[model samples]
Target: MILEAVMLQVKEGMESKYEEAFREASKIISSMNGYISHELQRCMEVKGKYLLLVQWETLEDHTVGFRNSNEYQEWKKQLHHFYDPFPIVEHFSRVML
Candidate 1:
């Protein structure tokens, strides 16, 4: 399994808008090939920070497959502007239980 972690900081007073954008884009993401699941987590201490965790069958599913698909373009159009600057994405593979 591959884990894609995206940490984002939204503009003040735009949390609901960002959330709405995510909801709109989630349909495309969830339908992408090799997609497993996705979750959005809100930080308790931070006011505008969110964690987007996506699970895929392999790294290529996210790095290549999703990037090459038309769905990605739509997803990008819907969700790209929600961040202040941009979100940083990282990937990981489980090494232990």
Candidate 2:
């Protein structure tokens, strides 16, 4: 599985609204192909910081399948504006221990 990670810094005073929009945008992402699961974690020490983790069956499932779809536009419309500076999304795979 591929893990997608993003560090989101929401605009000041927009945390609540951002969370609400995130909840709505979740549906759009969840319905996409090859999506395994996702979680949004708020930072306890930072008011506007959040960590978003998403598991996908493949990198293209997100980089292409989702990002290329119309649903992505909806996702962007809902949550993109809340970001202070745009977040960088990175993908990872499990490392053998």
lDDT of each: 0.93, 0.96
Worst 10 residues of 2 by lDDT: 88-97
Q: Please, what are the lDDT tens digits per residue for candidate 1 over residues 1-97? A: 9999999898889999989889889999999999999999999999999999999999999999999999999998998887887988899999999
How does each model score on TM-score?
0.95, 0.97
Model 1 residue 51 lDDT score: 96
Off by over 4 Å in 1: none
Tens-place lDDT digits, model 2, residues 5-95: 9999999999999999999899999999999999999999999999999999999999999999999999999999999889999999999
Q: Count the backbone clashes (under 3 Å) in each candidate.
A: 0, 0
